[model samples]
Every structure is written in C-alpha cells, then in structure tokens.
Target chain A: MSAVEEMIKERLKNDIDPREFDKPEFQRDPFPLYKRLRDHHPVYHDRFHNRWVITRYWDVDAVFQNSEAYTRGIYEEEGPYKFGSRHVFGPNILEYGRGDRHRWLRNVIAGQFVGQKLNDFLPVIDMIARELIDKFRKDGEVELVTQFSHQFPIRVISNMLGLPREDENMFVGWYQALIAGLGFGGVHLARGIAARNEMWEYLEPLINQRSKNPGEDLLSRIIAAELDGVKMDMDEIKGFVALLLAAGGDTTDKAIANMMYHMMYTRPDQFDRVKATPDLWENVFTEMMRYDPVVHTQGRRTVNEMALYDEVIPKGALVLIYLGAGNRDERVFKDPDTFDAFRDDLHMGRENRSGRYKDGKPGHLGFGMGQHFCMGYAMARQEAVLACAYFANSLKNIRPKFKEHAGIFSPNIDSGGFRSPAELWLEFDPE
Target chain B: MKLRVDYKKCEKAGECYYNHTVLFERTDNGFPKILVEDLTTDALRHEAREAIEVCPTGAISIEE
Candidate 1:
C-alpha cells in the first residue's frame, strides 16, 4: 500500500483493546480481530497481557525460523534446571529449549513417529478407529465428541503402548485430567499433577519389565531406541509417554473433530465431492490444517533484540505466534477466509519441519516450522486422515445432526487457545 | 556428489541415521555421522535426498 493509502486505512481503523481477547465472542471466532492486528498492528505488544502478539504469515514463520532471536519449550535458559522434574509431565522434551539436551531428546524419539516405523503402527490405528466407530454405528446417531472423537486416539496410544485392552478407560481418564492441567492452573493443574503422579507410579513396573524383557510394542521400542548406545533414562521415558498421551492424543483428538466440523458444516458441497471420490479426504485434512488448525497460538520468547514493523522487541519479551491468524493471512493466501479443500496455492501434502516445499508453495503454519516443529507431524496427519476416511466410509451417509454448531472456542482460558467444537452430533446409517 | 552435514543446522534430531542407517550412523552424542558421503549413482543420490528431507533441522544436504 502507498503511504497515503496506509494513512487513510490507519485513520479509518479503530485501535484494538487487549481485553477483547478475554471475551467469549473472540473465543468463538478470533479471525476478525486477527485481521485487524495483521493489518494495523502486525507486531502488537498487548500491554494488558504483557506479551507481543505476532499475527501475520511471514512474521510467524520468521520467529519459528530464527532460533537466534527466539527460544521455545517449557524451561528457561537462565536458571540451572533439572530436566522434567518440576513439570507434571516430568522431564519431557517440551521442557528443553534449543540445545544439546533438546536435540538428544528429539533424535532418539522422533524416528518412531515417521517412515516405516510410523507405518508399523498403522494396523493399530485402523483397529482402534474401527472399534470406536463400532460403538455408535448401530445407534445411527452419535454424539461424536465423547463417543468417537475423544475415545479414538487415546485408545490408539494405549494400544500402541501394549497396555491391556481393558485398561484403556483408565488411560483415557488420566489423559483427560492430564490435558486439563497442561497449561491451565488452579484446580485443573492440581488434578493434572495428581493424574501424572499416579500415571508415573503405574508405569514404574511396566518400565522395569520392559528393561528386563523388551517386546514388539511401542513402549518397548521407546525403551530400546538408542543413539550410540546412549538412551533415554527412566524418567525421560515415562515423561515422554505422558507427553505423548496428552500432546499426541489430545491434539489429534481435536484435529479429527475440526476436520469433521468443516466437512459437515462449513463445506457440505466439498463433503459431497469427498464422499463421491473418498480420496479427497486428504485434501480435507490439509485444508483444515490451514483454514482453522487446532493449535492456534505457539509461544516463543525473544532471546535477542529483534526488529519487526519499525519496532524493536527487546530480549526476554514473550511472543505469542497466532498461527490461526497466519493461516488466514491475506498476504499469503488468496480468498484467505474461505475453506477450499482443493486450493492449488497451499501445499496440500504431508507437512515437513522446514516449511519450504519442493513445489515452492507455503504449507500451513499449524504444525509450525523450522527447529521446533511438531515431532508428531506425520503421525498426527496420518491418524486424522485414517480416522476421517474410516468415518466417512464405514458410516453410510454420515452427516452433521444439524446445520449449526456452538462454534469452536477455547473451553477455558487456561486451555491455551486450543479451539474445537465442544460437542459434535452426527447422524449416520449403520453399515 | 558428496553428502554434507551442516553441523550448525543439525540438532541431532535422529531422522537421518536412525531411519536410513545405510547412509548415516549415529555418533555417541546422537549426531549423524555420514557413512556414505560419496554419491556416484542416481539411486545413491536418491537415497541421500531421502535422508536430507527427513532431518528435522534440514542439517543434511548434497554437496556437488
């Protein structure tokens, strides 16, 4: 925009109130305010929240790419930190910043989630997905959130761990409470910590058994995955399993719901095409990752002074990267608000850590980019795709119960802006 | 062409060595030690690229 045009736009636009973030309407839908922030205050320093908000596409990518300027993960760099001792997850990978410790943790665990190793777990994913769908298939109408969406991934995780099939409900309960405490404080945090401690104690014997006699299960694989004979210690192993259950399970749980919400409600026409071809389910997954990702805000702290939009963010400032805003960024996407599953502009394949694609298209910022990109990217995408395809295929003529939903929102303030339909009711025929 | 390990970029996120042991091996500290740097055939180059693509940090690349 020209200087005169920019001035006019600025004059017409009203300043944003930081309190707007706390409102229910913003919770239900954040894109409007996100647009305003992107256009006017691309690098907004919200005084009320005492944090810098990054909303644009390139800006969010820049923060993810530049490790020199920002630091992610749960622990701080300044103090002497005991790995995962303090957090509810107990010394998982999330606690480490960018360093040798973080790299070592990531290297050992990441291989299990990608390539043939990830594919090895496919039968379990399919079986669990089928089992969950079987529960409500005979009913012809199902409350998807509790009945299918919530139960599916947690069961898959448990089964992968070689847990007894009967103990899944216990894992589910722990997962729910643990997720509640993830970023939320007060009562939720207390419950979450209690669940974690219980889970840790429960895993002690299991870890011991695995050490003595390893098996073909994921838990055994995790125990045995080594680098130059160095391996994850007991605490690290248990912490990772805890992290995986919540981080991998809960986020994927939300992701599956989001895909259904968009397909059944937002774009019923596209749903018709997908139902007709069925292969387009992958496109639906890709579009949902861009259109409205489950993970909206990714936090980073400025480790060095940085310049953005004529303003300098000093070191130690908290930066909230709004990926929800970035996906809808007009500068990067054409017809940014509309959810088009088959759009050519967006990279519609599996995501990679380096956001740059061989096709030269910008992928969704949902999984994030660069160094700290989601480790479970491949597994999450595959699991969601599998679950969605199975749902649409197995349940004959599956569709939303009603045209309207309560809309996606963070259920609680401490939910860390994770948004999805609280309840998804769907009507389908038994196959 | 030879495989180059960008030490600065590689964070030892074991996507390469663990999955593709044919092209790389793990160091004691978990960094990927290149086992086959020399690529003389299209198949070898293909194998090298596959390794490069999976690195979480984009630390590995082919050097001509």
Candidate 2:
C-alpha cells in the first residue's frame, strides 16, 4: 500500500483493543468507542476476551429474543457439574434456560411484580422514599448513593417482604456486600458467600413463619406461590429472596443514583423540565436506561453455528451482547449518543420482554429482552421512577453538592458494566 | 395442530405475533391474537413451533 493508502487504511481500521475496555477512559465515556464498533465492526470477535461482541441494536435484540440460537444458561444441564454451584447468588431462577422449572418460577414469581399485584405494593415504595428522604432532608445535602438511593430500594424490598423494619440496615449491608462480592473472585467471593449465608440464616425463620401463616408480603407470596401443584422449596425460596436482594436491590439503587447523576450533571437543562413536571420522571428513567443504564452488558452463548454480518460464529461461543453499545447505535436511534428524554423515536412507555413496542419505536436493551429479560422490569422502573420523583418533589431546589463530579463509572473492567457514580451528593431544602 | 395461548401465563411479550405475523397477530391490546388456529402444513407448523419456543413465558402451545 502507498503512503496515502496506508493513512486511509489506518482511518478505515475497525480494530478495538480489548485492553481499551479495561481503560478508565472507556468506562468514563464508552460511546465514542461504541460508535466505532457500530459503524465498522458490527460483530467484533475479541480473541483476547474470548467473546464475540454485537453492538448494533437489532442484533442484540435478535440474540436476546432467539432462544433457538442462543442461551442464557452458561452451564451445561447434562454435565456432571451441579447447576448454580458457583453462582454468586446460589441456585435461582436465572441459572435456568428455557426449561419447565424456569417457566414455572417465572410464571409464579413474575406476577407479583406486575399489574394490580405490583400496584398493591406501591405504598411501601412511597413510604420508604419518604422515610429515607426525611433522614437527609435536615442535612440540606446528602449523598444520593449512601443516604437515599442505596437505602430506599432494599428497604422497600425488605418492607415488601415483611421483614422487620428494624433489621432493614442489616439487609442493606448484606446486599452491598453481596453485589461487591460478585464478578471478582477470591476474597470478594468469600465475603459475598459469608454475607449470603448470614442473610440466609436470618431468612430461615422468616420463611418458616411466612409458610405457616402467609401474609400480604413478598416473602409470604414466594413461600405460598405455586403453579401446576409445584412450589419453590426452602433452598429455592431463600435463594430467590437473596437473589432479589442482590439483583433487584443492586439494579434499582444504581438506577436512581444514575438518574440523579445525569439530571444534576449531564443534562441540567433537561432536568429542569422533569422538576417542573414530576410525571416527566418516567421519560428520564427511559432515556437514562438508553443513555447510561445500570446494566450495560448481558452474557449469552451461541448454541449453534450462526451467520452474523459476514462471519460465521461457531456453536458454544461466548457472546457478549453490549446493550450499552446497541442503545447508542446510530442506525436504530437518531443522534444516538446525546441523551434526549423527549426524543420521539424511543418507545417511552411500558416495555415488554419481546423488545417490540406498540409505538413502532425500539426499546432499550438495558434490561435484556426475551425469556431472561429482567424479571424485575416493572418493579425496577416503578421503584426508580418513584424514588426519583420522590427526590425531585421531596427536595426543593436540589442541586449537585459540588460543581465538579467524577462522573459515572464501573469501578473495574470485569465489574460487568454495572455503571453508577461512586457518590451522588445533592443539596436541597426540605419539602 | 391447534394453537393455544394460555393468557394466564402470557406476559404479552409479542414474541408470537411479532415473530410470525401470519400465524399470530396483535389483538386490540398488545397481546398476541392467533389468526389461524389450525395449522396443516409443515411450514406453518414449523413457524408455530418457533413462536412457542421463543415465547419468554411458556404461554403458547399446541392444542393437540
């Protein structure tokens, strides 16, 4: 190649160093790199990472929706290995892929989180928001993560589970440790298991109590939940509850914190619109999910050799569907990188697992569509929106505590892209 | 083959209608509406099976 040809070739190169994913700059702002992936290498085979990356919106959706080609279950069912033996949260519904048990568990457990059943739990959400806000309202300024966002969701969950109000702090501690313990092996895993065991022991009596005399709480519902004469046993019940505390608690808390971080920093002008109209908090949540969601990537493995854009991916290949990248695909979304809540292209309404919306607009893949879609989709959205609106309405003139912020980050490359600001400090007068 | 959508278990994910529009279409609401309940051809049966398999909720099934 000539000199001019070489320079042009350099510009045309779509190569993405796997190390870039680990760099601090990528975590701080990955959209530029995401755009590069979308524009050039739609299906990137990262040899270093031992995974295939799909960045386009529709491709991610296709993988998520197609159980015929891909599976969320990483472990082989027929293997000598026990399922969920090494899972951070233990044996739970998530480890299963397209099976009768998964369907059964999803059927019974999912209902409690949606429709009128979910509506019944609304009061607990509002009550917790009020309680948390009340504590920091006097301080005039509070760290959203520590003071409000972190505490609110877990407390709501604990309250919904009918756990003792006084033990809410313990629940919070265990969840934090549980989340911190995951994706990093050794000491983190050890601490996580310790926390899980401690919480499991604490839940033993509660599960027994609920089973004997069921109440309106979530724990009771799980214990009493049955379909086709099948019910979750002791380990399953406790495991699900613990998973909820970590998975549900982890996502919802980070969501609230992310929204606040964006509103107070990324889009203060747009934040004004939401403040004026509390209902706009829904839009903020939706946009935030697309813009910089709590969960950025979901892991799925290909079950068969499949033809992607140009290359054939072999069966049993690890595919990392980068929802964050797909959310910013210029093809599916207009002005993809810029966060615009009122943008007319997005669904901006209640999302479904199929990734298809009635509005003819595509939905964000943050929750990961299809069978294994975020089971807590409605609950997470409800909790995050209510808490945000609660914060917006509860705190008058709430603004960032400091003019300079470190912005949102994943803390570690292998953290699996659970992005949230380390600390979100906001100051506002008591409502 | 006759198709049945167990509405009780259905989350209205649109997998059936969205994926196979001829066999199933959207109702007045977002839930899937089976256009042709009876399938005789192998192609049609294959499509129905695909819908059943893709459904996040095990709502779709063959009647017999």
* Fnat per candidate: 0.00, 0.31
lDDT score at residue A45, model 1, on the 0-100 scale: 86
List candidate 1 segments past 4 Å from native.
A1-13, A73-78, A225-230, A412-416, B1-64
iRMS, candidate 2, in Å: value is 6.6
Docking class of 2: incorrect
Q: Residues A153-232, candidate 2: write the lDDT tens digits.
A: 88887877789999999998998878877767788788888998999899898888779999877888888887667787
Candidate 2 Cα RMSD (Å): 5.4
**How well does candidate 2 match the true structure in TM-score terms?**
0.87
- Model 2's alpha-carbon lDDT is 0.82
DockQ versus reference, model 1: 0.09
Q: Residue by residue across B4-63, what tens digits does model 1's lDDT show?
A: 999878755556764566788755454678888799888789778867766766788888
Q: Number of clashes in model 2?
A: 0
Enumerate clash totals for all models, in the order shown.
2, 0
Worst 10 residues of 2 chain A by lDDT: A409-418
